[model samples]
Target: MKNDDYSDVVMAALHVLEESGSLPNIERENKCEKRSDKYREEGNIAFKVGDVNRVLEFYNRALMFAPKNSRAIQLAYSNRSAILFKMGQFRACLIDVETCCKLGCPTDIESKLIKRKNEATVRSEMENLSANLLTGYFKDCFKFDFKSNTPIRCASSDIEVMKGDAFKVVAAKDIKVGTPLALEDSFVSSNSEKNVPFSCHYCHKMSEPDTM
Candidate 1:
């Protein structure tokens, strides 16, 4: 039978069986278990070939079809969390990891999953910290303090403007020419310059004269 025609025929036959109440009592648990594993295997194959979209689709279907509180459900969540972490969706990955853990993830892989959870948690927290830094009362002056923002750090108190995406920054007071708004130094220091003729390469500091 042609594939398209077969679908319609099967759908009609199944619908009629359902309506007539003649559909045999299939073991739903076994059926769901089999189908979920089948889909998860297909997703794994697609993932191996780097077919990201197809992998996600199959894994999602597996998750939807998986029986509640079943090993299949835990495995599907664990597999999808791997994909989410690879995709840099840390928050989504964390949710899946938590669910898998609650469902009693396989002992063989649980340690690895826990490690992944910790790394993703750190990245998620850093993302939140950055967003908070750039918001609210810190909005205008948020970009000023940087232990490492150099490439540049804002230095002018009169100026309320930030560099990256800010537009109108009117100086609250008259600005002098050559006033430093931001300054950043390269990570490198050298002894080649006259100021430091001989400096340690490690710390870039010149040696002191011998007192003895």
Candidate 2:
């Protein structure tokens, strides 16, 4: 009920309990159970709407009311992990997954299987090195070319190639489809005779700077 709904009768009952020092005597467990249920309900609603962060917040509040509440812990960790994973923060996802596991959540076989599937996907993504394969902000890959059989080092030049399409390169590289690259701290020099090597940022193949 809203605060204003506590009419004189409600206040009188509270005052009576206060004077009698019986407020604390009421079972704290019952009060917490009620609040926990309310918070969990709100949290579930947030989860259904894809507001994962807000869902975690509500579940955390429920946990404060019932620290050992299994559902609260499970929902908090699972939702937080999923959001973090989607945001391409796999490192953070790992931590949340561990916490969820340690909290005695996923007691049932189906729940455990679901958690394992999510964990596997995140883990596989974390191990991949290709910038295009990587989701989130890091996936904005630049293009470059490298010499064949050499490592396609990250470069700042704009090089674009369709998948499986090979461009004539001044050099060649051995990197594959999933190499990670960034434009930060990269340089493009105007020197003609320096013979700097470049790589296709998309395919990570080797090429020369002058030819591109």
Candidate 3:
């Protein structure tokens, strides 16, 4: 229903209840919490069947009706975090897990929330690192040279390789097909000659300057 229509319907119901003096004595918060629990139960059923979209829909409805700072609201956020994690939305999952912790999650579930938050943090960091490595800036700054024992060789001249893009590995010399390329610890590792630590010497995890 439209917002205006729903408001009208609620007003009409209030008027009827007032006239008949039949309105229940329950508090609005209690009623909303009960309704939210009903939706949460439905969402749990959807989760069991691996229906991601349906679970999200039902959980969202539960959140809409859950009272602020209530257990129901905390539970909704916690449940949604799991779904986000499964969908590979690590940042969002971390946010939800943090919210659940702030809302004082039950002792039984607090440990689980902490573990989920840690996992999301690690995944988010790895994703950010991959993106940074794929950027043109990082590619221009670092040069990847294969060592003498390396199976695959860098054909920078023969191949028109673009910066910040994935390129096919070509052997320096003709070899049989399906040859395994050993990329582990084969590069000549070196730190910047400058007196400053511009980036990590190994993983290239950058750190902000003290001036910042």
Q: Which candidate has the top score in lDDT?
A: 1
For model 3, residues 1-212, the per-residue Cα lDDT tens digits are 74545878889999999899998788545438989999999999999998877787787788889999899999988988887677666777887787888888978889888899999999999988888878967665454453434222433222233335676444456655544334346466555443123357666654442211
Evaluate all candidate structures by whole-model CA lDDT and list the values in order. 0.75, 0.55, 0.72
Off by over 4 Å in 1: 1-31, 136-212
45-83, model 1: which lDDT tens digit per residue? Answer: 999998776777788889888999988899999998887
lDDT of 2 by residue, 99-128 (tens): 677776666643653665577566756566
Candidates in order, TM-scores: namely 0.50, 0.36, 0.50
- Candidate 2 error regions (>4 Å): 1-34, 69-71, 109-212
Error of 3 at 147 (Å): 40
| C-alpha root-mean-square deviation, each candidate | 21.2, 21.0, 18.2
